[model samples]
Target: MSTPGKVSLEDKFGLFTDHWSPKIVGELNGQQVKLAKISGEFVWHAHEHEDELFLVTRGTLLMRFRDGEQRIGVGEFIIVPRGVEHQPVAETGEVWMLLFEPSSTVNTGTAGGERTVTELERL
Candidate 1:
């Protein structure tokens, strides 16, 4: 068994530089805590049974929805409710964020395609 310790978001964010790929850092109650670096635009999609929480750590995130979009800045977060179509964009530059969702939640949601990450990497 392993003992609990502290996780440094800055250090974990440094482990990888790839965009759109989320690395698992922790898990609790069937939920996963992930870290990801994002830039450019991501495919529009929706989770059928799970809500997603995106917490901006550095830079900003523009979340686009069918009707409008919400801008998320560092230390702030936004929750995309289940079944609500939305897209994540980092128009300014690279953005760092923490993701909170169900362990079974897929990054690409129901729009599965090339961007779908079937196997997740653990930090």
Candidate 2:
């Protein structure tokens, strides 16, 4: 009722059909929490301004950064700090990514690689 005051997952899912980009589902203070479906390989990027929190809601996620690579299974999470360049790679499976960042966070804050999340893809 009253427009539900929030959009459902199915409605949000109809908002995008791509990769890398995360769709805003809700917010906490000045921080934004979004859900994104991803596959294949993403670009090497960094926030450079703030830390980023990623949760694997489904499937597995492989995050590779300047240091090394870490495999995150479903129900797992990883935190990447500022200025740390990282790339995300999914192994031929669907993944639900919940990202927490500032309200003005960029998909590729300081990146020069391919597969950037310029817009919501596969929301």
Candidate 3:
């Protein structure tokens, strides 16, 4: 069994300094909770079977879809359904976000690139 305790978001965010790299913080059921600091643009991709949830904690995130775009600000979240191609961009500045997804989900999805993280580091 795992010990129970508090997981500080600020403390977790402080452990990493890379963009687009998500560090695992906690897990529940079959899902993993991750934190990432991102700026600039991410590649367009889609998970065939996993949906991804992104909650903005720091700056603004512009989520672009094939159809349109949605602006996610602090405390706001957006879930991208499986098989939907989308991209996230932080044009103004760095953005901190919490990601919730199945443990099997990959960061880059089908659009594998240099940013694809097959193995994630825990915070």
Candidate 4:
């Protein structure tokens, strides 16, 4: 068995420098909380049956949809419903974000390819 302790977002975010790849931080009730650093544009994809929540921790995140786009800034978050085609972009340098989704959620969603992360690293 393992002992449960408090988690610090700042300390966790400092663990990696990779872009787009998310690192798992915590889990609850079949859901997972992840941290990721992103820059530039990401693949346009949609979760067939999972809703994804993105909470900006640092910098700004641009969420592009078929109709329009939304800017998610620090302390702000956006929830993309299941099956909504969307893309995340960080044109203004690196951005830190927290993602809340189901444990089975894939980074690339339905558009599986090279960017798909089948396994995630736990922090």
What lDDT score is found at residue 117 in candidate 3? 89
lDDT of 2 by residue, 1-123 (tens): 365476566567567766676888877789987888898887788886888889887789999987789999878999998888898889877777788888777887777445555554333
What's the ranking of the predictions by TM-score, best on top?
1, 3, 4, 2
- Which pairs clash in the backbone of model 3? none
lDDT of 4 by residue, 81-100 (tens): 99999999998899999999
Q: Tell me the spans in candidate 2 whose CA falls farther than 4 Å from its real position.
A: 1-16, 112-123
Off by over 4 Å in 4: 1-4
Model 3, 4-122: lDDT tens per residue? 99999998999889999999999999999999999999999999999999999999999999999999999999999999999999989899999999999999999999999888999
What TM-score would each prediction reach against the true structure?
0.97, 0.79, 0.96, 0.96
Please identify which of the two predictions, 1 or 3, would achieve the higher lDDT against the true structure: 1
Candidate lDDT (C-alpha), each:
0.97, 0.79, 0.96, 0.96
User: What is residue 113's positional error in candidate 3, in angstroms?
Assistant: 1.1
Clashing pairs for predicted structure model 2, backbone only? 17-122, 18-121, 18-122
Report the lDDT tens digits of candidate 1 across residue range 15-96. Answer: 9999999999999999999999999999999999999999999999999999999999999999999999999999998999
